[model samples]
Target: MGDTLIDEPTDLSVRLATVFSQMTRVRTFRLMNSAERGPWPALLKAVFTTPSLTCLEIWESPWRRPEEKFTIEALELPQNYSSLQRFVYRVPFSDCFPRESKSYGRRDRVQGSVELSNLRVLASLICDSVEVLELPAELAFLLTHITYPKLRVFSVQGHEPLQLAEWAEILRSARQLREVHLQTPIGFTEWSKTSSNWIESNSIPTAPVPQTHSDDLIMRGLSNLESLTISNPLDPGKELFFQFLPYANLRTFSLKAFPPLSALGARWSGIHSQVLTSSEILCILKGIQLINLSTFEVSYSVDAEDGVMLSHISSSFPSLEKLEIHRYRSLAKYNSEYDPLVSMPDALATATNLQHLMLNLDFPERPYWRDDNLNPERYKVFHGFLESQVASPFTGAIPSLKTLGILCHDAFSSYWDTWEVSKTRKLVSRPPHAMSN
Candidate 1:
C-alpha cells in the first residue's frame, strides 16, 4: 500500500487484506505527514478491510492548511464494522450535513467547505467498538450521533467549546469513559460559528431547554471516570469542568499551569493558571479526598510556590504511588514574571507508597538574598531556605521507592549524594524516563 501510486493500485483492499490477515498482531495503521493526499479510495478500502486493526490515524499534509474540501466519496459499510479501539482523525470541515439526518446544524458556508459525511461514515463504522476517540472540533458534533459502550478515553482538538447538550449526550452514551482530556479551550465558540455564519437568520431555539438535565447527565456519566487532563485552558468560562470536580472514580488527574491571569489575552477566559486560584486548589483537594488516587501530575509554567500546595499534596492522596510536579522554563530572566518557589522538602514526605517521583525543580547556582518591597523578610527567608533546604525524605520515608528522576540543572548537583547514600536504593543521575503527567 505504501509503494503503490494513486492510479497504479488495483484491487488494493483485497491485496492489503490478504497481507494483513497473515499478521495477527499488527494493530496500528497510520498514514501521516504525506506530501500528497495519497489515493483516498485505496486508503479507505484498505482501512475498511482490516478486521484486526485497533488504532487508525490519518492526517492531512502536515504543511498544508488549505480551505478543506469534502472530497471523500461516501461508501456503504457492512452491517458490522467492529475491531477498532483507537482513532485520531484531524481534518478541517465546512458546513455540510449527513444524508441519514433530517436537519444538520443550520451552518452557513462556502462551495468548497468540508462536509461531515466522511467523518460521520468513519465514526458510524466504529461506533460500537472504538474505546478511544480523538477528533477535530468539526466532528465533535458526531459525538452525539454514535454510541460507544466501551469508550473510555476521549479527547478533542480545535479551539471550540463543545455544545453542552450534545457533549452530555455523548458522555451519556460512553458509559465507560475513564478519562477525559481537553486542550486549548475557546469559550462560547463552536465549529460552525468559527467556520462560517449561520444559514438561518433566526439562530435562537424557540424552545427553552433545561440546563440542569445536561449537567445531571454529564455528572452521572463522569462518576465512572478515573483520570482527567486539561491543558492550556483559558480562564473566565470553564463551567463544565468545575462540574466534574466531584467525580466518583477519578483517581488520576493532570493539569498544565500557565502564566497568571494578568497574561491573558482579550479573548481568553479567566482560568486560574498561576498559583492556581484557591478554588482550583480546593478542587484538587476535593479530588484527593474523594478518590484514593494512585498517580497525579501537575505542570507549572511560571509560578508554583511549593509551600502549602506541597503540604496539601503530602497530606492528601496517601495511596499515591507515582507523583510528578514539573516546572519548565526555569530561569531568573523572567524573575518579575513568576513568583519564586519556596523549598518545602518536608512537606512531600507524607506519601508513604510513592515509588517514582519526578519534580523538575532546581536551586539557583548563585543564591542572592535581595530585599523586596513586598514581604522583604519572607522573600529573604525563602531565598535562604532555597540555599539551605536540600535534605529530602525520598529514601527512608518512601520505603517502596525505587526510581527518582529530575531535570538536570546546575547548582542542584549536591543532592546526588542524598540519593546515592540511600538505605536501599541509589539516587539516579538519569533513568528510564516515563510519560509526562
Candidate 2:
C-alpha cells in the first residue's frame, strides 16, 4: 500500500479511494481550497468512512461563487460520522436572503435549496457528536432542523442576517455549548426592543418544525456559557453584549469594536461619538456582577477616561486574573492627551487577583512590517518607559500581577512586548522569541 496525504486537492479516483480505505486511522484530514467540486464527493466518502477521524477541515476555493453549493452527491452516510468531534467549513461568505425581501427570496430559494440539502446531509452525518462546529452564518439555519446534542464550541462568521428565532433554536439544541464566538455584525433588529422576550415572526419558517420559544431558550443558554467573544467591525451592538451578562457563568469575555471611519482618514475629524461613555458603561454594568469572570478583554472604545470604567470593572469582577484593553483599528486620537500607561495602573489597583494584563497603545513612530533591519532603539525606549513608569507602578498597586504586556501596532510590526515581574519588583522582558501578536 502506498502512503497517501490528502492535504492537497486531488482528483480522487479508484486508486485514491483504495489508498484511503486501507488506512488504519485518520485522526485529522484537511482539504485545502479547491475550485473544482468533481473530486469532493469521492474524497468525502473516503473521509467519512474513517471511524477514527476526529477533525475535518475544508476550505472552499476563494474563487467560487458565494451561492455555490457544497454537494455531497451520491455518497452514502457513514455510520462512523459520530466520530467527528470538530468540523470546519470555510467559504468566502454566505448571505441568508431574508424572507422579508419577497422578490429576492423567491429568486434565490432555488440556488439556496441546493446548499440547504447539502447541509442537511452533512448535519445528519455528524451533528450527533460534533462538539466543535464552525461554519458561515448563512448555513446557521441548520440549527433549526438538527440538534447538536454534544456541541460545546460554536462559531459563525459573516454578516448574514440571523434572526432571534434562529439564535434561540441554536441555544436550545446546543445545550452543552460553553463557548461562542461571533465575528459578524449583529444589530438590534426586533430583539433590541425587549431583552428576553421575542415573538416569532409569522413569516414562513426558514427551516422545518420542532420549534420552541426562542426568548426562554436564549435565557437558559446564556446562563451556562463560560466564554463569549464578539468581534464586530460595526458597533459591538451594546444591547447584544449586555444580554449575555449578569446571568452568564462566563469566565472569559472579549469584545472587539472597530474605530469609526473618521479615524481612518475620513472627512469627519472630530472624535467619534460612539465611544462608550462613563455613564453608558455604568448603566450597562449597573446591576451586573461578573464574579466568575477570570479573563476580560475589550477594545479602546471602552472608556479609559480617568480609568473610572476600568476601576469599576476590577472592583466588580473579583476573580479577574487576566485583563486586556486593546484596539481593533488605529485611532485618530493618537494626538489626544490620553496615555494608557499613565491612566490604567491606578485604576486596576483593585484587581487584587489579576495576574496578567495587556494594554494596546499607538506606536511613537510608524514601523513597517517589511523592514527587517528596523531600529531596536524604539522598542528599548518603550520597554524602558514601561519598566520604570508603568510596570513599576503596577507592581505595587496590583501585587498579584506577574506579567505586563504593551501592544503596539506599526506598519512594520505589531506584537505584544511583554515583561515578567519578579519578586524583587524588577521588570524583565521575556526573550525576543517569546513576543507574540
The prediction achieving the highest TM-score against the true structure is: 2
How high a TM-score does candidate 2 get?
0.73
lDDT of each: 0.53, 0.59
Clashes (backbone N, CA, C under 3 Å), per candidate, total 7, 5
Which residue runs does candidate 2 get wrong by more than 4 Å?
A: 1-26, 32-39, 49-51, 59-73, 92-117, 186-212, 232-248, 258-282, 302-306, 327-340, 364-366, 369-372, 382-389, 409-413, 431-437
lDDT of 1: 0.53
| Model 2 score (lDDT) | 0.59
TM-score per model over all chains: 0.67, 0.73
Per-residue alpha-carbon lDDT of model 2 for 179-198, expressed as tens digits? 98775533333332221111
Q: List candidate 1 stretches off by more than 4 Å.
A: 1-18, 59-76, 90-115, 185-209, 232-237, 257-288, 301-305, 328-344, 362-400, 408-423, 428-431, 434-437
Displacement of residue 97 (Cα, Å) in model 1 is: 25
Worst ten in a row by lDDT for model 2: 193-202
lDDT of 1 by residue, 172-200 (tens): 78888888876533233333452444222
Model 2 lDDT at residue 35: 41
